[model samples]
Target chain A: MSLQEVFRNCAEQRRSALIGYLPAGFPTVSESVGLFEAMVRGDGHTPGCDIVEVGLPYSDPVMDGSTIQSAAERALRNGFRVRQLFDVVSAVAASGAVPVVMSYWNPIHRYGPDAFARDLRAAGGAGLITPDLVPEEAGEWMEASEEHRLDRIFLVAPSSTEHRLALTASAGTGFLYAASVMGVTGARESVSDSARELVRRTRAHTELPIGVGLGVRTAEHAAEVASFADGVIVGSAFVTRAEREGQDGVCAFAGELGRGVRTASPEPAGG
Target chain B: MTARDLGGAADPDELGSPDSGSHDPDEGGHFGPYGGRFMPEALIAAQDELAAEYDKARRDPEFVAELDRLLRDYAGRPSPLTEAERFSAHAGGARVLLKREDLNHTGSHKINNVLGQALLVKRMGKRRVIAETGAGQHGVATATACALLDLDCVIYMGATDTRRQALNVARMRLLGAEVRPVSTGSATLKDAINEALRDWVTNVADTHYLLGTAAGAHPFPLLVRNLHRVIGTEARQQVLERTGGLPDAVLACVGGGSNAIGIFHGFIDDPGVRLIGAEAGGHGLDSGEHGAALTSGSPGTLHGARSYLLQDEDGQIAEAYSISAGLDYPGVGPEHAWLADSGRAEYRAVTDEEAMEAFRLLSRTEGIIPAVESAHALAAALRVGTELGPEAVLVVNVSGRGDKDMDTAAHYFGLVPEAGITGEDQQ
Candidate 1:
């Protein structure tokens, strides 16, 4: 299913979509796939995660917080390869949720963007979320994503200028990722006050669905962000839970966050 | 990303501006296709702000005047070029001219960039400055600059470096800078840079990442190179005045290629001159334990720019090794990558044994204990001198003094004696 369909489904349900993230080879390849399946399984009533962000573990994850960085290190130390991503994606696709890959630019650049895009699409993945690649440096990525018909999600920060906002927003083919705070990816006690303002500013540029990520953890945090954003992304929190508790804990948290998005009455479409 | 076809080294006339020198990168901060900002969106504003400020400051005569004054008065500008005749006896009768960056305040060429960047931090109204250092020379210099400028300073250094260069750590502390020893990936220069970037991302509101070398994200490589251009400018004129013409070749050690790039810029326009950069070969290139990125690596993104990086086939950064802590890094500056690719410069790997021999030779011959990092250049000079024979004139940048490295040097050469030996006993 397309990212648009995922958001449209969530919109029809009068709620925001839940997007989950996990580095592909955390602990081991087989175990990581099982964890992803658990996240997508939901509470059996509502979808656990409308989209799964399959993180490609990289060596220097400068943008990641301790929780995610540790997980990525563990994944890499366990001999995670680029080909392992397709295996995980193919497995997650069978679970009835849209799977998107979140990676630093180099691995894909090294793997060849066209080959990566083609393989990702073949494995039933929806798109890509590049945290470090800005639109200005994405000339090749832009063409490759276009050729493969993959949703190219780009990010905007609270620090982005209006000109940059318009440029980055227009360059994104999938959705606009709004970093909730001016920091790296981690679970925070509360989402930043700047998230709503950033999402509001982004609305002025494009009608693409906006997902709020970075510094989002608990169900309350999810509900708080879902009130304004079209999608709510949770990453390090789930990774943290998986490391501490097992698959059951992840499922329980996903269920809680899945319901969390529904608890808050979203702003009116025009509002 | 696929290598963008940025076609060969651009000619000034082809760039459509005759007055525009070949020293500057493009407006996008790309040195051909090798240098561009591959950073997070959150830091885009900071990068843009820095780029804009540097653009304006470089053009403003007042800013240049202030910077020049500080270099002259505080850091000791126009560091003398000395004739190393005694050391030349070992170098195939070549006349070796040593650019004495070691004589500068704080004992290295690092002072030039640190003082300039510290001033920039103050201009930007930032009160705190954070920097990453490999060998602690950059850390000590940064700490000294912050003390002089009255700004709060923090330095991130590898945990291993902290142990090896303990004297520099004490110096930094004395200069009133907090040294945080990073224990992450390989716990070396690469990890130190990673930790520094994290600190910058979190506290960009009131802190400037005073990057130590001519590597990293956009505006950094460009600005650092510009700040260190004085070394080249001074050496070029000093060479002509001393020897009636430019030197046959110029050489400096390359960690992130700061000193080499700095001195290379002076003779970049001199088509007849040769530029050589010597990277650290810790064990040997064949042993896979070396920091010779340009000599043995491929194009990949690391730190913040696309450059030649020591990375695995899967694009994972490989840990770099070197006996000299300062010359250990996984990547080279993008501009050096451009120069090597364009055949404007050549990079050779100098093994630890060769570098140490040069380190000892310079000390015995000229009473100058050069930093182990600079000895890499001296080692390359020995080779190049032999290749060029007696009539050749060579200029080598002794980028730093060796006081901080006494402990390592003592250990390397077994120079350490028993604890209670008197001077008379030795005689």
Candidate 2:
């Protein structure tokens, strides 16, 4: 499904869905895939996640928090690689849930973006999110993403100015990842007020959806953010829960977070 | 961290090393397999031009004369080679020699590399210099050079490091270099490296990347080590003159491998002089708990080139963990890799426990508190001295003073003396 379609569906439901990220092969490659399947089949792996963001691991993951860092290490020790990441999308596809592969530029550039886009699309990936790949330098993959009918999502932090936001929004297809803070990705005690302002700023320039991330971890954090954003991206936080508990624990944690946000949804008016 | 900790020996335009070819990187800046034109294609010629200019400056008699004068008058060069009789006495009667780099203006061998690089950057017409630092020692040294040169400087540091080494951070700002906190990735030295590289790439037009150790893409390792060799060269001469013969062994700590190579290169041809490197064995070598790149790491490419790297089964780089920031990395200089493989140097792993013991040992016995990084070498010296017996003489590179590491040491040793914001407490 297209990201726009996902956005439309969320708009109809009046609730932002969960886009959960687990570094591909967080505990192990086989387990990573099994986790993806479980999350989708409602077998209780990351329960209630509307979208599965299969995080492709990189040697230097600059944006990760402690939880994600540990997960990446576990996955890396299991020998995760760019070429083999497709198996994850394939497994997630088999379970029939939204697949969004997140990664850094080096791995994508190294894997040949065109080939990667093709492979991901073939494996039923819905979109892509790369924190390191800026639009100016993304010609190599931006075009390939379009060709493969995959959404090329981009991120902008609260520190980004209006001009910068407009450019990011203009270039972005799936959604503009509105970062809640100025620092690296992680769960923080509170979300910045600029987050809502950023959502408004992006809405001024583009019709593309805005998804807020970084520090939006708990169900309350997600619900609070969903009130202003079209969607919420939970990385380090969910990854944290995944780390503290096993896959079952993450499913239970994500379920609470997802249900919490969904409960905040306004009821539809009856005729 | 801040730059004041790097107070140094020479002026920015005129560093301790005379514009001698001893310091210039070749046409594109290199020393053996150690140097190369590893920058982007656009910056390649710019670096070459800088290298050529350095060559011309080296040949200039006036430049040589100025460097010589500064070496004598400013840096207090020919830093004493102290004979550690008391410590040596503990060495089972083996004579222990020390290259007193701790006496250098900045209290370490780091000044040698920074001064040379800062001088070259000025000659190359760069107005600003940037560096990435871990423990803030190299940053202080670089800041000192920039302060002396009046060059605009910026240092990238992981945010976590700033908190742990706050005094050093303040020290840098005092020296007039801006400290940029890197909040990215683990908030450690590696992230600082990434941020610094980004800064270098973006500001290439007016900036020079002043690398701290014998690592990086090319020319950096070679350029840095060559500048630092003066430490070994002087020590070697002093040791020879004092003892009337070459020491049985020369030992130094290995981080990016510059200091070890600095002193090692001077004695590379001296077959009789045994060269030893002590790496950070954080916990224990048995549990894969060390930075013994030469001993445990395999030949692999990392940072910028092929070298001895601590990697996993699939060859992915493993995060280097150590009590000392300087030694927290997975790779070493290519030259050291060659040295290790060729069996030219004997490398050993010294754990934090051992290094701490040596730190305390040196402080109590010699009244000389040495940096934890340097303590590895001291511990090795202690071990080797005991093994070699009474007639043997071992020279250990006291790379730097332990003042900067005072807090860490105190905390680690459970010597939690209530240190307020006192004048004496700060490094």
Candidate 3:
């Protein structure tokens, strides 16, 4: 399913879509597929995630906190290759969730953007989430993603100006990733007040679905973000749980967040 | 007299051109297809603000005048160019003129960029300055500038560097800068840069990341290079005044290529003068233990810019090795990559052994203890000098002094007794 369809589906249910992320080949390549499958079919009843973000492990994950960085390091150390990402994406798509690859820009640039886009489209994947690439430097990606009919997601932070927001919104295809705070990726105890404000401000710029990420830790945090965001994107929390308790832990947490998104009270109007 | 001078990715073939535009990176900061902003969205505003402010400041007479005054009276500008006659004897009797950046107030060319950026920080109304360092020279320079400017300073250094360059750590603390040892991702220079970027992302509103090298995102490669351009400008003028013409070739060591780029800009417009950069060949390029990004690496992005990077086939940044802590990096600045691609400059790798030999030779022959990073260029000069023969005039940028490297040097040459220092300490 396309990302727009997932958001539309979640809107019909009156709930925010739960998006789960796990670095490709974390722990091991073969095991990662099973973990992603677990994320898709969480708790065996309600779907765990409408979308699965497959991380392309990079050596320098400057935006990642210790949990994700360590996981990526482990994946890279285990000899995870770029080709393995295709297998993970294919598995995630077969399992249930729309699979999208989250990668730093260098790998895609090194792999050739057009070829990467073509191969990804062939693998039943939705698109790419480039954490490090801004729209200003994404001329090739813009052209390639357009040619291949893949979603191109770009992030906007609280620090983004109105000009920047419009530029990002226009360049983005599938959704706009709203970083909740001025920080790297990590699970925090509470989602900041700025996240709601940022989401509201972003609504002025683009009509695309907006996903709130970075520091959406507990179900409470997810629910709070769900009130204002179209999608509650959880990454480090799943990785942190997976580190200690493996796939089952991640599935259980995903189920909790999945339910939380449905039960959230709407944010007060103008808040 | 003023430093005002000076001057990835994509389609496996559609990015970075040898001749892109007039301003090198042009407006959006692209050199050929290398060198553009590759930072997180959170930091784009900061980068843009920096680029905008720098654009205005370069043209603002008040800013230029203040910077000039600081360089002249504070950092000790117009560092003399000395003739290295004794040292040149080992290089087939070539006439070698050394740009004495080592004689600057802080003992290196780093002060040039640091003071300029510290001023920019002040102009931007940011009170806190953050930086990352490998050998500690840049850290010391940043700390020094912050102290002088009365700005709060925090430095991130690799945990290993903190141990190896402990004295510089003490020096930073003494200068009132907080030093944080980063223990993640090989615990080296690149990791420190990552940590600094994290800090910048978290606290960019009141902080300015005083990037130390001419690598990194758009404004930095341009900003740092412009700040250090005085090196080449002064050397060019000095060489002309002293020898009546341009040198046959100019050589400087390349880590992130700041000093080299700084010096190269003065001579870049002179088609007659050749620019050469020496990279660190730790064990050797063949052993996969070297920082020779330009020599053996491929085009890729790391630390916010596209350049020649030592990376795996999958685009993972590979660890760069060098005996010199300052020269240990997996990536070269994008401008140097452009220069290499355009054939405007050539780069060669100098092994740890060759650099150490040059380090000792300079000290014994000319009473000048060169930094191991600078020694790489000196080693290259020795080879190039021989190739150019007796009448060739060469200008070598002695980028820094070796005071911070005394411990490493002592261990390498066994200057200290066996019991005083162990091989494990060197490691």
TM-score of each: 0.96, 0.62, 0.95
For DockQ, the strongest prediction is 3
- Which residue runs does candidate 1 get wrong by more than 4 Å? A269-271, B1-19, B418-427
- Candidate 1 on B1-427: residue-level lDDT in tens? 0000011122223222214664578877788889898998888899989988776666555666777788888888879999999999899999999999999999999998998788788789999999999999999999999999899999999999899888889999999999999987788888899888888888888999999999988988988887887788889999999999999999999999888888998899998899999999999999999999999999988888999989887888899999999989999999999999999999999999999999999998999999999999999999999999999999999999999888777767666574333333222
lDDT of 3: 0.91
Task: Tell me the interface RMSD of model 1, in angstroms.
Answer: 0.9
How much does candidate 1 score in TM-score?
Answer: 0.96
Candidate no. 2 TM-score = 0.62
Give every prediction's interface RMSD: 0.9, 9.1, 0.7
Question: Which is better, 2 or 3, measured by TM-score?
Answer: 3
Score each candidate by Cα lDDT: 0.89, 0.73, 0.91
TM-score of the second chain in each model? 0.94, 0.88, 0.94
Point out the higher-scoring one by DockQ: 1 or 2. 1
Q: Which stretches of candidate 2 lie over 4 Å from their true place?
A: A1-56, A61-83, A86-271, B1-56, B418-427
Instruction: Quote the lDDT for A52 in model 2.
Output: 79
Estimate candidate 3's RMSD in Å: 4.5
Residues A42-76 of candidate 1: C-alpha lDDT, one tens digit per residue: 76665589999999999889888888988999999
